[model samples]
Target: MKIGNLIRLVIFGLLLVFLIQPELFAGFFGLFTKNNQPAIYNQGSLLDITLNHLGIVAAATLASTIIAVGLAIVVTRPFGAEFLPLSRSLANIGQTFPPVAVLALAVPMLGFGTAPTLVALFLYGLLPIFENTLTGLTNLPPAVTDAAKGVGMSGWQRLIKVELPLALPVILAGVRLSVVISLATATIGSTVAARTLGEVIIAGLLSSNTAFVLQGGLIVGVLAVLIYDALSALERFLMKRTGQLGRA
Candidate 1:
């Protein structure tokens, strides 16, 4: 009901309209320029592709968030600080590795389809989520920890009741970043016969049909926008509800 929400809705409507009916806008303006081929947008293929892509992305993201954040928590204390740099280095290496190379090496073991792609996506998601989780929990005010101790709260109780809630916003923002990255990386799954929005783009690239590429890329962008926007809104809502952040 708020004006900001209204504006978000309006923008979403416009994006949906264009994504669902790209030809309407494409035909209005001459955007396709490839090998002089007629533009084509295959709806069924696009839908199937996007769905599979989202599936791989979601699985990878969920797995990465669990593993990365768990490890981050394990390595943050005085006794564990020695492990912090190692954990961070591994995270950095995960991001530095080429997903294409990962896929190539994994293909022999995992075969084709979504499995290898899932591994690559999972690896890509680990660093940001891990770093964010660590930073969020560490940023807590020392006074809050003291207050928890003064109340005779157990360590786990302090973590669950105070740290987790206070750190949730930053963790959620990290999740948002991983989500967008996941959506984009899912496109690469198409190389291994895994369905995704990248199918059209790759097909276009191979066949010299620019419209096909444009359609796929645009749809992926639109989906990313929708998912990120929703997550961002959810983050804001939770932060406000927790009283950890001021309401806008």
Candidate 2:
């Protein structure tokens, strides 16, 4: 009912309509084309391309979340505390180099297509999730953890029932950042022969078709905004539910 929600709804609706029936906007895109060049990207369906793009990002983010969160959990444990620096360094590796550089390196070993792109995205997404999770776990209120211990909760039980739940909102914040970054970065995967919205943008670039470029960029941009907004809402909800809203 709020203005911001209304705007998000309208944008999401338009994105759906565009993906479902892109031709309806041909005239609009045509304004950017020259010499009667085709306006829509006909090489692949916009809906299919968008779905593929989301799939790749989702897969990579999921993998990144599992590994990063696991590493954070391990490093926070007493026995694993000494490994914190090493874990941090490992997570930092993916982001230490530009994504393009990672892709270039991956291509030789993984071959072209989705494998290399997934690797690049997975590695690039790790640092944020790992850092956020680590921060969240380490910053827990000592009294709360002490209370859990006093209640006869085993270390594992305390972590499962007390720590992770409280830390989840912070972890989700990192996931949100990683997901948004992956959405934009995944577009570049097309250069490695992966099926993605980047195909439209690359084609437009090669042909000097501004329309194609605009269409592709618009879709990706809108998707990033929408997903970011959605994840932020979820983060706020979790923070409130976990009594961390005031801190936020």
Candidate 3:
């Protein structure tokens, strides 16, 4: 493997180790602590908090992908073309309102915990996926789509067999962007009592313990980078398979 690839693997391995056995690094973290404070966050298990964080992000990202991709597909269809503006506006709502504002609005209706957080993340993550999917579907080579129709494929068949396949790399790019954003944004969920790595950072901040903040930030940062790299690899693979690598 290339040196870059090898380094990423090594970093990923360390991340897994850190999550699973954070206590093992207590000595390292101790350097950042003062006044006899605990180095590792003892209020919660790093592994559990990390898992919950991942779960929330995964759920929100999945929902965003499904809804965004579906909306993009609808808008791209001739019958639904007129609604493109509406769809764009709807997706833009998430971007227009900040996640914290969404959380504030949702908390009264959804209550605290995961529900409000999910709503915030779901809305926050919509634009990238929706816009990318729309761009991908709208920018397809007319010749390729026309050939599919010329071969006697129905509209649905053409979309399913030809258009979607060609557009997947682009769609995946959007999903990747959303996922990375969600990973970082989800940290704020802890402000409303949601279980997330934000708890660690918040605790650190409240107690003036830099160790906790660094630990939480480091884990989230590493996770975002690793996930981004993995998705980029997938996008490149798909582009290569579709003979669009050169274009990329």
lDDT of 1 by residue, 1-248 (tens): 99877877887786566655656665632467655565666535454566677888889999989988887788875668789888888778658888888889889999998898898988889998998999889988788889999999987798889988888888888989998998988888889977778788888888777788877887788778888989998898888887766633
Q: List runs of model 1 lying over 4 Å from the truth.
A: 1-4, 10-38
Off by over 4 Å in 2: none
Q: For candidate 2, lDDT tens digit of each residue in 24-62?
A: 999999999998899998888999999999999999999
lDDT of 3 at 209: 98
Better of 1 and 3 by TM-score: 3
lDDT string for model 3 (22-84, tens) is 899999999999999999999989999999999999999999999999999999998999999
Candidate 1 versus the native: TM-score? 0.87
Q: On TM-score, who's better, 1 or 2? A: 2
Kindly state the number of residue pairs that clash in model 1.
0
Best by lDDT: 2
Query: Which parts of model 3 are misplaced by more than 4 Å?
Result: none
Sort all candidates by lDDT, best to worst.
Answer: 2, 3, 1
Q: Residue-pair clashes per candidate, as listed?
A: 0, 0, 0
